[model samples]
Target: MAEEVKLFGIWGSPFSRKVEIALKMKGVEYEYIEEELGNMSPLLLKYNPIHKKVPVLVHNGKPIAESVIIIEYIDETWKHNPILPQDPYERAVARFWAKFIDEKCLPALWNSTWSKGKDREAAIEEASQHLNTLENELKDKKFFGGEEIGLVDIVASFVGFWFGALQEVSGLELLTEEKVPKLCKWSYEFVNHSVIKENLPSRDKLVAYLSARFADASK
Candidate 1:
């Protein structure tokens, strides 16, 4: 068995938190090596030389980069809880949404935070629209991929955990119950799930960190 699993990541990063929650959900015991963002450890750079990003999953001797990829790898390797769906079509749908979150939804989230005046207003609208789509998709399901939190849930985790803090930091409200009611409920549920709750960073600390970072970025 490839028993040795080590994760290189920072606590505040949504990407890192996603991978950490995946491992925790799978009941996989692994070493958590917290990395300092600016002064990254050599192990991180050596393993993920191209991107030099955190949340790199090192299993046995091999390394996997990217949050979604690492999550998929963990699902395949662990084989217990089954994060991704077994059906091909269902799995494809899951992957599609996951990718959409990373490429489209997350960018809209950043734009909402990073831009100014009219641009910020536009970004909030764009993000709110995306949340509406996700809201309808979530509908009656407890999670994005159904009753149990699965691949898509992990991918959309940022909206659940981080974005609330981001909204507070930027003074932008895009995920209110009135805006995307289903998704708003889904976000609260996702973040408070037993496995997810324990794995999250402190809300106050996260907000303070984000507030400072956003303030710095705006300068």
Candidate 2:
């Protein structure tokens, strides 16, 4: 029997959008359930009781949490437009970068935006160093997986879809082409790609959302 697929996520969440993009790349049909973060639904609560986070993937009544893990599950299950590399070593490298992006780059980017003065500068330098490392890894490739959007691409959604909006929100110039030309180009290409372009939240909307949060945090 063909399994049913359902995804619960909020509109402005890049992590949630990562799952959407992964499913699109794999050509998997799913019911997209928009969750209200302030008033999370019982279904989301039930499935992800531990984290109570969005981007929960439920396939054949089984639930998977976390965007990267869900994308990996989708890659394994669908098997058509694959995300990970076939060879063990390449897959390991992909996983390493994915985790690095998540653990190191993402936090540094967010902190750079959320902090002030010297702290912000330090965060920007840290984020830039991480991006430079990724830039060297990418070299001249169009995508992280060398011609295809893969796991690393999914995890790097912050760069693809939200960097500009976050820049507006934080009033910072972090991911400019002058700073990281190749990564900047990849971000534009990834955002405008046919597969997941329509799924993106409006840049203005994200700016508004994050700006409000910054204001509240500043007060």
Candidate 3:
């Protein structure tokens, strides 16, 4: 019998989308359960008691939380269309970029979008530096991991999908044709991939959701 697989996620979460992308890329079949982040379901809480975050993958009654971890688990378990490089050195490089994006880039971007005044400016500068580093890194390669999309690509996929929506909501544009030509092109390619394109949330809806979130946070 095929093992039962299910995913608990919020539609607007980039983290959730990351896992979804990995699952799709690996051709894994699973049930998707959309959850409200504000009022998380009991099942989600039960599955991830520590964080209570979404994008929890339940396979054969075992729960796995955290988006990147879930992606790694999916890749290792399925092993059909590999997301990580096979070469040891190349794998380390891919993991490094993925960690950089997850830790440095994401936090800076979120700070820029969600904060105000000098703090926001500082966040923007930090995020710009990260983008500059990524631009330099991608100067020679087509994708972050080289010729094909790999772990780094999956980790950085939010730059294409959610980043633009956040920029629209926050009234700031980080990735532009003139500012980061290669990144802009890469973003287009990443988001336009059939699986990603089909799975992304509507831009208008995301903007409204983010705007509401900002308003609520301010109050």
Candidate 4:
């Protein structure tokens, strides 16, 4: 019997795109099922009942939720192209950065875009600090994973792509070339990566979507 792989995800979501990029990197063949947050599918609900979110990867008869976890699973299962590091310590570091990106950097940056008044100011400060931390981390390295696109690079894909688009829509200037040159350079490299570039959604479409969403949220 052949292995059956299916992914349920939203097209415009960075989280969903992350998993898709990982799958492409590992040369995994799978089915893509688009989902909407407003009208989430029953199968998606069953696969990820707790989160009720998209980017759910179903393998054979089992289901896995969470983009980071699913990417790790993809790396582990298909031993061809490794996304994480080989050494134990390096692997730990990769996981650490990935966690930091998801938990710290993304939330702060996102809040800075969506928030208002003092809250927005505070969020911008917090987000800038995190972005600086990432800048320092990428100071001398070609990629966060060093020389190649690895776990951290994959995980930080939003900072490289979506956040920039969001920045345009929100007009919040946190991730600038002067403020974080290393990160800006890294972003250029990350999105232009052949596999990653192919997997990304249309920038014009993404920007238009964010513009309308932000306008609606403001009103």
Predicted structure with the largest TM-score when compared to the true one: 4
Candidate 3 lDDT, 67-171, residue by residue in tens: 888988998899888998888898888888889999999899889888889999999999988988888888867777677778888899777678888888778
Quality of model 3 by C-alpha lDDT: 0.87
Q: Cα RMSD (Å) per model?
A: 1.2, 1.4, 1.4, 0.7
Writing each residue's lDDT as its tens digit, candidate 2 over 1-219 gives 877999999999989999988888888889999999889999999999999999899999999999999988998988898899999999999999999999998999888888888998899889878878888888999999888888998899887778778887777886888878999889888888888687788888888898899899999
Summarize candidate 4's per-residue lDDT along 96-128 as a digit string, tens digits. 999999999999999999999999999999999
Candidate 2 stretches greater than 4 Å from native: none
Cα lDDT of model 1 by residue, 1-219, tens digit: 558999999989999999999999999999999999898999899999999889899999899999999999999988999999999999999999999999999999979888888998898789878888888888799899788999999999899988899889988888898878888889888988999999999999999998889879878
Lowest lDDT sum, 10 consecutive residues, model 1, at 171-180
Q: Please, what is the whole-model Cα lDDT of each candidate in the order they appear?
A: 0.91, 0.88, 0.87, 0.94
Residue 184 Cα positional deviation in candidate 4, in Å, after optimal superposition:
0.4
Candidate order, lDDT descending: 4, 1, 2, 3
Residue 192, candidate 4: Cα error in Å is: 0.4
Displacement of the residue 156 alpha carbon in candidate 2, Å: 0.5
Kindly indicate the candidate among 2 and 4 with the higher lDDT: 4
Model 4: worst 10 consecutive residues (lDDT sum):
36-45
**Reference-based TM-score of each model:** 0.96, 0.94, 0.95, 0.99
Estimate candidate 2's alpha-carbon lDDT, on a 0 to 1 scale: 0.88
Question: Cα deviation in Å at residue 10, candidate 2?
Answer: 0.6
Better of 2 and 3 by lDDT: 2
Q: CA lDDT of 74 in candidate 1?
A: 93
